[model samples]
Target: MAIDLYALPVTQVSGVKGKKPEELLALGITSVGQLLDYYPFRYEDYTLRDLTQVKDGDKITVQGTIAGVPQVQMYGRTKSRMTCKIVVDSLFITAVWFNRHFLRDKLTAGAEIVLTGKWDQKRLHLTISETEFPGQGKSQTGTLQPVYSITGALTQKWMRQTMKQALLQFGELIPEVLPAELLTRYDLLPRKKAMALLHAPGSLEQGQQARRRMVYEELFLFQLKMQAYRALNHDRADGVAHPVDLPAVRAFVRALPFTLTASQKQVLAEILHDLQQPHCMNRLLQGDVGAGKTVVAASALFAVVKSGYQGALMVPTEILAEQHKRSLDRLFEPYGIQTALLTGSLTDRQRRDLLASLQMGLIDVVVGTHALIQEDVYFRQLGLVVTDEQHRFGVNQRSILRRKGMNPDVLTMTATPIPRTLAITAFGDMDVSTLRELPKGRKPIQTYAVTPAMLERVLGFIRREVSAGRQAYVICPLIEESEKLDVQNAIDVHAQLQFAFPEYRVGLLHGRMTASEKDEIMRQFSSNEVQVLVSTTVIEVGVDVPNSTLMVVYDADRFGLSQLHQLRGRVGRGEHQSYCILIADPKNEVGKERMKAMTDTNDGFEIARRDLELRGPGDFFGTKQSGLPEFRVADMVTDFETMEQARDDAAELVRRPDFWTGASYASLRQFLQRENIFTGDLLD
Candidate 1:
């Protein structure tokens, strides 16, 4: 009997015996299905390389016949090298292999062979990493060759052989999961055909079709899952009917220190509208740093409290929660709305009092970390749930908090700017409102990319700023020493900067510090007690100080463009003209582009676009999202239209029981399960 494709291990397959199983496991290739998902990252067009056009330093592939016996050169007893001469139609090139003396017999005269490696122009030699011969039955020029990510134990030769075997045996059994309508609309190939073409295409064009099919499949299923979530959340019992217009809430908004920007006013209005809806409100509020997201969230929370209901705000870190507590406490105190703080570091008595107040409706609003989702914490009449930094928490975590009450309105906020296309795909289930404009009275920070040669001049500038009654933030890429990465860290930068500014106060902040220690350090920095705060990315959010006027980021190239923008935003809040100095000597072109983007514009959206284009969507979306699935083929920048179509199709499918809730959707269900997406969980 043949084995099942889903459960059959690579060890059970032919040609995959021996230590290949262990090597395969290192690449997450345990089961046949997983092995199939491990498609080649790229392919080498060995079938059509012209030997005449091959240049030095270029990676090329060529097919030729052995013209003579191989030469073995020995250096010492343990070091040996083998060299062979191969000829094409009228051209000849020397191929070299290191430490493979046994290959001499295989290089006999007139042997047809394929070689792929770097071409050394200086010696006109090809340093071959892969070689295939017709006699061995491994070299086939008719098929485009696959190049995959490899480990030392697992080479491309073995991987290709194993994948080929798997496809030949199981490809026929792979079911068609996409509906016929979608297949016709998108011109996609059947699943089995796509697998065959993608794993071992006879031509490059066929491989392209396979790629489109796979990308469509990934984004299609992902959008379906997101649409299902929206449907489930919308179908839930009506949420709290919080009153939006109340005397206290109106008064609080009028009393705000600075006028709300046009973007903020629009988003605030949208939030209030969502709160008035009968169904549960699921919305994502996005903006750049200093875009007044907190104030917008505060306004919504105020409306909830004014209507005599409780509101909860969850942040990524304890320091951020504490800062929100202080900021909101001050904002709502005049409005007579009580606020409480709950975090992991809170004392037993303090937590007890807060929980008790929450249950009794004494605490109108609560700002907390993940502790807000604990089973023990209960809300009196939870009307709204607001989360800062939406990417830090998944939809389930947000739902976990919402489940504590009767379907509370969910408003998630993020300081990072997501591209419009990404916003649709990632936040498809929720209404999105963007705040692109910063609040009034905010000064733009000047950014400049500097090399290490200007370190002295930058330090002198910081000294001048501090002496003029302004504080500075010096950010490092790492907290402590990392053996793998040779980058500046907070501790070393702290010691060096302390010496640089002996007369001024220099404090250090990193992730290794305890909650109280970080809070105290931030407090000192806020009070201008620490003129220079040499910290890691710990101050990425909510370390707002109007007096801080300068930011100096060491190794700025190590950070993403969006992150660099966030770090630059720490300063420039005050009325004075601010400056941001980025000390970076970028090694690669991408790093150079990131530094240039930071110094070019203050627009977060533009930075995000550049970051997406430069790093590709994979790295940009990895940590920037929590529950979103990683795409293997579909790029948001390239497949924007496909993503949009998938979004529409998925939404329609969810409304039909014949597809969404039936056996036809079984494969999609399995895919979502693997992606860790469940609409039932969101219905909670």
Candidate 2:
């Protein structure tokens, strides 16, 4: 159904009458429904009151009689904020208003008003920046106050008032979506009731319940959309079955220098089964670092080859692509699997040769970066596509690759094992295969957190490692010092190491270096030409030399837990024991906590959980990194359990797809469309 403009009601304050709806639309507040549905970003709870509970300088609601008159000072104003003071319950608190002083009149002396604001405990004074009155009732300040996201033209008060008015006027449009039976069974309030509680609740408990209802609803709807997509895909006619020759893949694995681990074999079996499915495969491969995702991917590629079809592997960066190509080339050579590399960095002659091989169907396994998805590129018989660190690429890029084939099986691999809650909420539409165990003979990288005082010992250890014919890696925080202050740099550290240990060779690598320079440095380190390599995180995944055993990270606190884990993965690649030392400051609690968490557990999943609990979803998941959904109400971290239940409900709803044909589901879809929560970007 098309959007119903009448579903949203107009408010007297939405516009000044003569201005444009087009103008309002530009502000993302076009429809009355949008205005009503524009939920608050946060809430300020100032409903609790009582002088007995109030401490000195506390921003509290004192119900005592006002003993003095308020004062308004003509303080010099810059571009914002005004200076004023008001007395409530015989206590003095500074009042600051942005541009509006109409508050002065409403907050008269001895007027028995409740002021809500911040306070300085040391100064024994409160900054009553906001005011409330009994006449305004609970609208001004209640258990939960709606704090809508606002533009310059819309103040918090304005948004609240406009939403309140819209709610009052558009009573007929706010239809309920959940069944009456389910509502009563789940003890959930109606949307209208929840909205009321959200804006103005009589008690904190009511506001929490209302929040729970809204969050669950929002999560359920999102999950339902995902399940719908899954259902729709399931209904599509599957492609021809591409049978997998398990014997061939097993023989290839058996011929390998190392034996496949239980987890690797398990995941490989799942991938093989997926490739054999008549439907085009859309699988997610989640494996911890050093869990042998590459071998599993190779096995899938073998199946593709056995089926008389070619496979394509895409990486996010040219460096990583080159690395994967080199690694896969070695593995495929013994099996007579014709493999080739294609990337932007390749010379014209090289690219032409590679393209020729690809077009001729001679390259059985082609690995490259986004260059594979270029418009000019064509595949002879691309049967399967493997994307390494698939999370780094956006959904659009993934889709573009899929469109390159006749619906080839897609196997996306990620080094990070996403939390289960995130996988459900963010990647519910895709099938997932997890490689949870590390391969045999891999030593656990011992991790430690130390202060600057231990720096000398760390350097001494590096010297000892290099002297023993093994290599070590020292990662600096930055390439150059900032203008703010001069900090240690990779270049400077390399020089320092060379000078201190004149007996050993030291090399430096950073992001600022040229590709040739980075390659040369990496080549040197790989061949053990350089005993010690000092660099930035650029080498975090660049090379895989087992000789490097000692890993030292300077200012480890600056890096996220997952990032630190990734860096630690650079070492301990060999059978010998390896160590990761994190040098940090002990006094900084945030830094200390991050370091402690890293040291406390070598488990990536545990680290991720702690990272979430300590820093929230944004910092833990690296919003920019994960591309995870950012919900204002639903938190995948704190609300994991609830999100699971919502996901189940979503699945059930999708099984009964006709439920959305109802007017209520239409309205629900309309609400989601307005919020961009179910936008096509998610599935693209």
Candidate 3:
């Protein structure tokens, strides 16, 4: 019988005792298996090199004999410097160590030593970052040394020694989680051999090979769990097969004031096709802002309601909900399709009356915020559910809304375009449909990035635009002055603009205001009562003012690329030419890149790809909200090809009848059960 390395504590290792165990625990390494799995974030090459082959300012590792006793000089209260001379290949070089007075006794005359650091060929000097005696227990001089992230007085030397001990004792006991056939098919290293190579590799190529194996393993496990969830959802028998009336739906589409774009038509066709399937529709509908997604969604709701079933549209904010309800009401008016709005701000009596109407099947469709998912809210034969701006809501919130009916068909919509790599990993379980074409006759917004020195000119442009009977919006990052950030706030900007343009009406809006107050301010802005509206990012999503042609964003460097694109989207909605002026003085390369990307093109997909590369997957959409998993060795950006292959393999394997019960799959089943991968819902 094999011992379970995962159950053995870190103390069971030879030298991981006393404070060492506590230190290891601080890094979340409680068991022997975990300690081994804590792979290095990077590696440092300490391969010994010849002095003749080294150049000036080259980082080199060399072994030599100390020519003299080291001397230590104390400076200030606790700072000290040690100097010594060493002979490498018959060339004398002075080595310096800062704040390492303890090494003075260790470096005696004629002692063999290994030093690694940058060399200054002109001065024959080396600033030593590490020192190792030639006869040390295990030398890392001629190899790639692993660099681990440490804390609590733990040194790399101690970590390497303890890891060698753990591997020597329990390496063979590391069970193989993947099947043997898979190992041979992919030409991957065995689990035990890979673990050993990760800690102590002979060369960079060897370490990369080891890392490839781990990356494939992590991605395979993630895909397997995603495929299992998809299978479970597909196998459900309680799904409602909503009716798809193409003739009626097309007629409704034809009656709209504007013609539907080719992309919108294709997406609506996909949604209608899913409605007739045996299983519920789990699909993601994504597009850039002003892509006409609402009209496509409205057509789907019309089909469900015409078939004698109800539909629900859930948004993120009350303002958005109200906007949807008003638009949906106008669209459904010709056919006498009734629509109602529900929000947290509704009165108790009004809420009770609406709930009663919905339960009694009197309401054909309802649009709401999170109020749609409350315990008291009920629906009569809800056949379709549409969530707008899907990323704003949590997974549980969406799930609760689906629970209102018998596995109703779901259509999730987002204005933020997600890259193909992220779409495959983060939303792998759902089928995706993208809308890339905007409506006809829509013009691109002219964008520019300017420094604070151009503030007066920008204000003058706004003044001219406003004097032409148009409105403008001035956006800030913060609601009030924050001690930590030096960016402009909404209140101060509003005050300044009000003073600068005494003849115009300037209004302030932020997240700190009440819903009704926000509604009133927005109402004023929409009606052109407030010509210059100074606000924060609270107006990024649903506030649409076609008359507002100018958008001036202060401290635009503080926002992400996607966010800036969204702010730029607020304008360019009307027929008149619009402009977006970005006021920023970027201090870093990434900020400069963002500014360039914004001013270069108006394609949201290109902007999204750049954002993913600059900010990485963790901050792309925010890891928690994005539903992206934290991997041990795999990176979402660099390892996207591995992820794609893993997804295909998992999909193929899950279709096998014996995958869940075969003896060859016992290890995978055990691993999944131990990790609790299947216990939770997908994308939660």
Candidate 4:
């Protein structure tokens, strides 16, 4: 039967058809095409070994046949050993398999075997440590062996055979996404041939080149999608031209308790320019935590209100929304612009009153969480919409907020700073404004890495800080005890801390708590009633508590550098000296490097760069697609050059009429259509 690689699911393949392959699905192998694309995690070198080239103490693999029956012998004690003579060309070497009496039975005369072990040149013997049977053929016969990542339920042989069969069956039918001319110009392998070579490459370099071809396709398609999304959204949405309220904005800025840094001033100026434009403002405002993003939002809100249009500030967490609401209300009160809070934690009466005021335009600015996305929530004139922690929200959520008003201006903010190269690749469609400078007099958090033995000292330090009338936070990687992870969890840690520190008030926070419960816990922590708060990474965003000066993160290696930076920023909010203790003993080099990078510098961009280098883009970017498509093969970190090239190529390609109307470009067009990027006039 002929099978189209794109149309045939992996379950239809032989060896997998009758096996209920949920295990393969768990590894993200769902189709014939995907299975072929599932590249090997590693390759084992199987270069042919020459007996004459063997050196003392060198470990190598040598294939040979048993020249004589293996002899069983006992040592001075009860230990049994099997000794055999193997012949390779003119040399006959002694092979010893200790505590392996079965070898005497299996190693029959003239039977071929491949043994890999350390050689004892003085004794002329090869220790038979690893064995390869006849079925495990070419892997030991001087060739590279591909090792794929799989669950215990799936064996390496099964995975390799599955890929080989899939390639043999449907490789020729795999559809190409790129235009022929473009593929030729880049010297990329054809999609069909690339998959074939990737599954069974004659050489290591050939396999890598084939993989690079796939990476280029994935990246190029992504750039094309992003550029199309930009064309559809930005080119069509012409926003109301709100004249810059310079005097009011200046007054709001001057009213801020602390002065704005040069970087903040520059970013705000760029945002203001976007706001007054005839086109919709699709701008990303990224800054590290404590970079005064709240003040910038306040100024933007003031300007929008001064122009007689309401504003909306949506955040990921209810605590953040309420915090922004109170702070904005106080900041804008002197300017006489009313602000209201709309969140899930609000009482029915409170929400009803706020909604009424918002509808009447009495509320010039409304701060909210996902509550703003509800169908009943109406805005009188939402001219400016600012979403905090924008990455936490999906593309559809932002689209829904934009729908509440006619081409409303948007200014999304992220406290997690992303590097410039990555930001351009991810958010190339939007103008970028960055806040890099922190407010003056804010001290840097002293970061340290410690093992389990230092936990008591860290706890003592936290106790001293709490006794001195300051607050602290203990963050756990897990919300609850995970039997599989074996890491410290917030619930168990909180219980242990409460018992250990009986004199102080301790609070617990995690994602499983209800909105009201989280809000109350945050309120207690902010008020200093809960002197030491034990929580999870839910507080990784903008949780401002000046009194909280110390932070201890358990299993810090489990988190990425960007997350570690954000968690550390939770402290050092006040004038008091702050400290961040990482309770970790990383097992690998990557984990240790992450911890070292965390303790080395406090700069978020630097940490982001290091993170991109250490963990690649997927883990660095997380599920926060940031309005960009997730890539399967292309890592923006390693393929930054290719990403840049693809980005340029995509920009040029979209400008051509052929890209939209040519017959060869039909598949590309269909892909963009499915992505909802090339569609037009949705802004209206």
lDDT for each of the candidates?
A: 0.83, 0.74, 0.89, 0.83
TM-score of each: 0.88, 0.87, 0.87, 0.81
lDDT of 3 by residue, 257-348 (tens): 99999999999999988888878888999999889888889999999898789999999888888888988998999899999999998899
Q: What's model 4's lDDT at 623?
A: 65
**Superposition TM-score, candidate 4 onto the true structure:** 0.81
lDDT of 2 by residue, 337-438 (tens): 998878877888888888888888888988888888888677888899898877667666777887777878888888766777766766777788888788
Cα lDDT tens digits, model 4, 1-684, are 544564677876778965437888888878877787788766665555887897898777888888997788887666788888998766899998888786567788888888887789988798877777566554455666678888848887888788887777676778888998888898999988887777677788888888889888988888887777765566453688888889878877887887889998898888888788778887889998899988888888788889889999999988788788888877887877888888887789988898888888889998888889999899888899999988788778888988899888888899878888788887777788898889999898999998878888998899899989999999999988887998899999999999999999999999999988988999999888899999999998888999999999998878888999999999998989999999887575667898899889999999989988887776666765456556656777788899888888888888888878899998889888777665553321
- Top-lDDT candidate index: 3
Indicate the residue-level lDDT of 278 in model 4: 79
User: CA lDDT of 62 in candidate 4?
Assistant: 87
Q: After superposition, how far is residue 35 of candidate 4 from its true place, in Å?
A: 6.3
Q: Write the per-residue lDDT of candidate 1 for residues 541-589, one digit (tens) a residue.
A: 7678889999999988788887888888888887999999988875666
Q: Candidate 4: which pairs clash?
A: none
Clashing pairs in 1: none
